[model samples]
Target: MHKRTKSNIAVMLVLALCLSAILAGCGHEPDKPKPTKNVVLISVCSVRADHMSCYGYRRQTTPRLAEFARQCVVYDNAFTQWPKTTPAFCAIMSAKYAHNNGVLRATHGPRLADEHVTLAEVMADAGYQTAAFLSSPALAAHSNIAQGFQNVDEVFVGPRRAVLPTIRAIEWLRKRDPKKPFFIWAHYNNAHYPYRASGIPNPDMFVEDQFYDASRHVRALKDPRAHLKADVPRDHPCVMEILRPDIGAIHTWAVLDERPEELDFYIARYDAGIYSADASIGRLLDELRTLGLLDNTIVALVGDHGESLGDHNYYFEHGRFPYDATAHVPLMIRQPRGAGARHVSTQVAAFDLAPTLLEMTGLTPPEDWDARSLGRLDKDTPGDNLVFTEAGYQLDYMLAVHDSEWKLIDVPNALDRQMMRHQEYELYRWRDDPGETRELSAAHPDQVARLAAILDEWAAPWRAEVYANWTRNQTTIPTETSRQLESLGYVGSNSSEDEEGDDGGD
Candidate 1:
């Protein structure tokens, strides 16, 4: 009987051991690997945030984009670091301000310095198939914006249309390995200057030929050698007849006495361009959906810089100043897996895009980058960080510092006597006066002094870096590229002495 009891006890111990092994098995399972994601970044040239319906603009200038915004995170107060193509893009790709990237002027410096690590390089390092399709000569391969990109297409030089780049991107997407992740940076230039009224067909209202002719004449006046001339004074009946009726008295560089109606016509043409560009973006999005890539890809649409469009006496261009008209741009991001739609009111800068993108893709940004990741933003978050902007060539420099509420524009005394004669410092409460119509520097001396001091401190490092690496020698642009740029009203001369005039701003 004792022997039988011992055998029963051993059996009970074996059963208990089996139960423990089963519990251990149930408690844990192997982790599944995370799915790889693709990233597509589209940078539209000369897009103003306020012009889109999504931003509360009355016009249906961007119906497609409005719809797209419904599925992405739309930043309401996104501003560019610089209001020019090359410099702005340098900021976007390098995650550094233009001043730090050493590409302050459009044509003044060599391509973005080799030291600055680019977004493409980071993606490539992480095994991404990187490609870029650029629509502007200002971002040509020689410009070094193509660094670390496996496939770079700068062939689309004239007219700044979006169709060709979209097609190229589609082809590249198809050719890429399906198993590996990819990154594409496509730039669209349709919303750029020299508005083509002809592109928009059968609009609700048509601009008269006289107004179009006048625009051409005004552009010709910028050329010192053009045969065309405005024989009549700007206020003469001949010019006034084409001016819009609603346009009140306003200052403009095109002509001193432009009619409100004429300005409206010009604006209408710009809106048409925006509509066309928005449609192109819609097509690209549709293609992604068709390929079943939309669900797994992170798509970001941003404007390199905003167009002035006759704001603050700056007409039909950018880069002359750091006003909201030129600095504020549209920034929208659609995350993978339907992250849902949200609007961020916090002020964000263009340089922040690169770092934000890296973080979204589960990658780490370089510690030295000036841009901070925007991934932490949420509905309850408040923006208290200051954003800085700078643009100039040679002796003429304009710097702006702003937060959500206040903005300060500082134009230092330069060799150009005319610019010096104007207000050296202009302060505005941006929230109260979005148009920046009034200068409050005289009214609030303390505020101006405070903001100016902050701007100076923030800019000290960039200023010192740019000065140390300054190169006076001109970059040798390809002949074809120069011709294309000149045709687009970018550069006036090929001579190195004329580099300052190249101001490939918008």
Candidate 2:
């Protein structure tokens, strides 16, 4: 009896132990995740390359960037998703085309769709500390651009708010436990509007903000209409009024066309603004180098969009179609010292920049995303990509896709007989006539047809995005949000775009 009892008790104890082990094993947390790799992306604005020496410009506007470019892969033909800041930045941050994102016009304050995925969120999921020092309202927190950033200092204006981003970024970098990973995007707005570095309180910001005076402002603002002599087609007389407002104060921003000397003066002012931004950036770069984080990180310098500066009958600001001066931007991808070939001429878009950076850091882009990594696409595996851009009214669609030599512009809803927005469509062979003055739609109908087909096919999916984002003020206090978006330079207030005729292309 004692032996039987002992055997039963031993069996019961063994069974209980097995059960406990199974339960405990099931409850045990998986291996602690791998430490995230750190990545820092620095996005600047409107620092035009033609105005800088890096892109073969006569001016010495970008001394700091030139040094960085030595090891970086510089893209000569990197274009923006949209010519305006908000839409363009939306494309860069969200990694989506502008039309699928939102209207990229001034006063356009539509919030990004909640469904849209951001690069920061992707990195954050991979166990990284996401942060952004956004110095521009063009990327306001009012939008979802700041969704994944744990410590985002978006108040990049005023003195108190000014030092915080740089100070905090350096502090975070210094204090960050090496065990954890990091992802930071330091967006600099020093080159944007209200052009005054004197108010910035940093002598290093600009060489001399006080060089130019009110007289320059007054003279440029006078008769702003007279400056629209950029070979605009005869029928497009109204373009002068539609693009640049008669508001006298706007011209002071950039005296592009008034006097040749003003061009020098205006460029000087812009150069000073660049210096201001460069100084701040140089500080951050120094911090990363000091921390020894520079080698492992891929620091990319790119403008969200570009400015016209009186090119092609355009003014200094952007909110138009992708003209050469406004759309073509400077892109420098400085990976580990010898990782990439020195420079590449692969044509890419702003929307693709984020994905490329993510890919370079060994992250996979979402399967449905439209952009591809430029690093992967080299001369050995060169890809001829057709980048699209939009601006102006929805009804005013401009579709441009080029193969190095030929660029075609389809301005649908042209008005006049000679392509002043009268006719339904207009096309131009850019290689034959780089200015795009000739209305060859009627002359060479086949080329126009082929381009139209290409655009229609590419826009089909983006059209679906249009219907999805279209709606009335779903958010309460819509006015303030709209105003914030307007301040960010997105065209139009928060309003549902309902018109069927409103095409998404520009």
Residue-wise C-alpha lDDT for candidate 1, range 1-506, written one tens digit per residue: 99999999999989977877776689943332332789999888888888887788777778888888888989888888888888899888998876667676554334787778999999998889999988767788657878889998864543434466777888888888998999998887766644442224533233453324334322213322332122334432112212211112221222212333356665766666677677777778888888999888999988878877656655676665788988888998999865967998788887788888888888888887988887756533464668788864433367888877889988773421233237778898987888888878889999899898988888776665554454532366677766555443334432212222221323
Stretches of model 2 off by over 4 angstroms after superposition: 1-36, 159-165, 197-219, 222-261, 379-383, 415-447, 461-506
lDDT of 2 at 292: 83
Model 2, residue 116: C-alpha shift (Å): 1.4
Which residue pairs clash within candidate 1? 243-262, 244-260, 244-261, 244-262, 247-260
Task: Report the number of the highest-lDDT candidate.
Answer: 1
lDDT per residue, candidate 2, 1-506, as tens digits?
99999999999999977877787789954443354457788876776766566777654556777777887888877777777666677778778776655534433344566677788887887788888877655566555667678888765445333335566688778766687778888876655543343224442332334543334432355342343324444333124324343122334223334342344345465665666666677778888888888777778888876665555444456565555566777788887763663776656676777788777767777765667677556543344567676654333445566545445555553431232434445565544554456667788778778777887788776654553443422222245444443332223222222122110111
Error in Å for residue 49 of model 2: 2.4
**Total clashes for model 1:** 5
Model 1 whole-model lDDT (C-alpha atoms): 0.69
State the displacement of the C-alpha of residue 455, model 2, in Å, after optimal TM-score superposition.
1.4
Taking the candidates one at a time, how many backbone clashes does each contain? 5, 15
